[model samples]
Target chain A: MNSLEFYVDHLFRKYKASIQIQDLRFEVLGNLEAKVADLTANGVGYDEAVRMAKENLPSIDHLIDGNRTIYINQFRLEYVQITLLYMVIGWIVAMPLQFIRTGFIHWLFLISSAIIGVVYLVLLANRKNINMQKIKAFNLNAVFDLRKQVWLVWFIFIGMSIFITTALQFGSNIWFFRPVDISGPYQFAMIAIKYLIPFASIIVPVIFHIAPKLIMKYEVGENDGYKE
Target chain B: MGDNSISRDIIRGHIDAIILRVLCEGDNYGYEIIKAIAKNSDGKYELKEPSLYTSLKRLETQKLISSYWGDESQGGRRKYYKVTSLGEEAYEKSLADWKIAKDLIDKLIERQD
Candidate 1:
């Protein structure tokens, strides 16, 4: 590789690689080669030509659109970690209430939430070694993967909520050691809706409205390091 | 290079138009486009590589220009840009606008002795 290519590669080494970035790198390298060749033909020494080519490209930040950059900061990851930790704590605290009034499935669901949160925290911690200094261009694949993960989490939570609420209402027929009259699926549906009403009404809305603001609190400005 | 900075700033806003004007002659690649601009301006203005790449990207995104990979006969595969029909229209419009602006600025700045 020429000095120009090596220089460009070194500058781009910190970014997460994607097809778009690869194409851009190739384009830049080819142009720099052409410029260096032109300069050398004009009586500039090979080394000086390469240096001039490098000097001409002061910054590559403009090569990618501002909106597409992924500025990986400590704050975004930490915010997610804290949010997951709070979820685990909340589920564990709610576990005792499950024993008094709810069935075994409800208790299992609560435990599962805590376990999932712990697993997520472990996975997140493992990813902490990434360099937080460099900003990178958007990776479409990563965005799609994250979307799939978010949907999977939502599906799992909602499915568990439905199952636990249904089990709480119909899984047993004993109430305070007395024989309780059992209704059909209609009554079970009513009970499930009753229990889920609080979750759907309150928790979901809170997550939608408040979580974004909370996460935004942790965002380090793009200009953080460059400030005098 | 004292006057170079002010001229560069004045020219920066119309970089897209300038590029489109170059591509209007024929399909061209990055270094060639820079050379063309420098030649046109008698070496007074040299478009920085960063600015040129950014403007080229923006123009491509706007569908004002399209690019293709040239055959690698010249050691490296050059990405050549062509002015689109929309780009030609944009260039014409910008040229007319610049004409009016230039005339007005000259009249305003000219000394009345």
Candidate 2:
């Protein structure tokens, strides 16, 4: 019976519980236990009975159909919203520094920020259509297993950023830290890129590491509300 | 077993109807309903647990049935499902539709010779 519960739980591990989902879970476990019991009573061994009971059920994909689509759409929305937020925040943070040091804000960065903001608003407005596309494209299993890989990528990103930045800061005559001889737009471009690199290196990794888990936590909370 | 796949595909199309017909006999919990279907088919057909719940959910959403948790003195608590008046009407309609489909298919596919 415990094994029966384990099997059903494993199949649904990716899904968050709602009232309907919870009821369905218990119903599935109860039916599976009954099937196993009947099979065992008819002289089938315990392990075989469990296996047969599992085999009699349909695939998890077939079972999840509609409910799973809701979660997938939510996940995609969270991913896009978080990415846009990070981009906007990155540009805003860089703006003040550019103004304070260079006596003017960089137009390129400001324009990029505006573009990102527009994109974010468009996404918010057309979320339903985007979600439909996502339902067809996103792989739920990969998203469920993403937290660990996200962390690993974050670590590698941080390590590489630190190594490159340290080498640039200390290495003899590295253009990154050296005083620029040019006096026009080329100089501004160089300084902007140099400043942007370290900021991006620090910020992008942190966002990558944190965003998925944040979305997952929000999904769990949303589902928790539906629990009876 | 080889022919079971093709038959199962045909059965899959009417899983909801089949489940509703079982509940038409009496209110039943998940396991009992599954067993009844299997028993009636002489073990030739067995609905998978997930598929059963999935159909049950669709039926519930359509207001064809309602469910309640059963208090079992032993083992785990069970969720029982009862057919709604709406469900009984849907079941009858589904049965009538199936008969028409079955007869049409039989006539169209049968050998004249």
Candidate 3:
């Protein structure tokens, strides 16, 4: 309603609405109003009273740090879970495709998927400890900078994928060039599709896992910000 | 009346205790608490709102004080804080501690002759 009230509300704009936060906000706003009322009653002008009240308010950093730990932890857990879910989904989609083309399930594909699944479970189990480490290592500036470079990370990943696919296709003398007796464009295309399915299954998960960490690494430097 | 940084830092450390002492007189809301501090100090000290809120939260977390919404008839409902029994004990402990510290500091800093 007044300048003090507006400023207090603005400060907490980013926080999600919850009972605890709402209670804190209500308490803070009431205090600011009372301070302004008292100051103005004592002959201080409304503008000066508002300014003094605002100046007395504590920094948002301390307030957020004290109150938002649980919310931040839940967000981090969800981020990890979603990333792992994408990996699992990639494997699930690839497994049947591989079987349909090759006439048999790929053992390597199955094993790697199981490994990634296990890693996912282990990460989930140790999430609390990992979250504590993350909080300790967090740098606000670095995180913002890392977020800005996300597009570059994806571009590099796509480039690497193209290079790997091209090398495997030609270097083995398989897809683009094959033995004269067995060579045919149809067979070459089918083989390339089969290999590409497996390659994608692996690469997609690897990229999903590495992209965020890569950004974190670039921002905070290797072995310094996050240990695992 | 002088706003020296060192004195302010010392006062900040005892903000929770100072707040508890204010509550001992009567239950007060946020603004009233600040006014009480200013009144008690004869306008010599004014606790900033941020530090005051932080200390209030810390005290609430420690269970030394409790807060509740007051049913104001107009404007907005105000939140009032009351010192718990635990807070009273803490206040006494902090007061004694301050006295000892004050006496010790005076002795240490007093000019010779």
The models' CA-based lDDT, in order, is: 0.69, 0.68, 0.68
Model 2 misplaced stretches (Cα beyond 4 Å): A15-19, A55-66, A69-228, B1-5
**DockQ by candidate, in order:** 0.33, 0.21, 0.22
lDDT of 3 at A59: 40
List runs of model 3 lying over 4 Å from the truth: A65-228
DockQ comparison, 1 vs 3, better candidate: 1
**Which candidate order results from sorting by TM-score in descending order?**
1, 3, 2
lDDT of 2: 0.68
Number of colliding residue pairs in each model = 0, 2, 2
lDDT of 1 by residue, A1-228 (tens): 767878989867756577787878878888889988898999999999988888777557535533233445544565455555555555655565454454443455465567767766665776667666555444344444555666566667777877776567645744345455546986665565457543532223333334344434433343332211
Residues A95-194, candidate 2, lDDT per residue (tens digit)? 6557446413344446656776776677678876764423222234555456557667767876776677546644554645675355799667665565
lDDT of 3 by residue, B9-53 (tens): 677678889999999998988888988998999988987666677
C-alpha RMSD for every candidate: 8.3, 13.8, 14.6
TM for candidate 3 is 0.54
Error of 3 at A44 (Å): 2.7
Q: TM-score (0 to 1) of chain B, per candidate?
A: 0.94, 0.95, 0.95
> Candidate 1's error at B107, in angstroms?
3.5
Q: Which one wins by DockQ: 2 or 3?
A: 3
| Model 2 chain A, TM-score vs. native | 0.42
Native interface contact recovery, model 2: 0.54
**Among all candidates shown, the one with the greatest DockQ:** 1
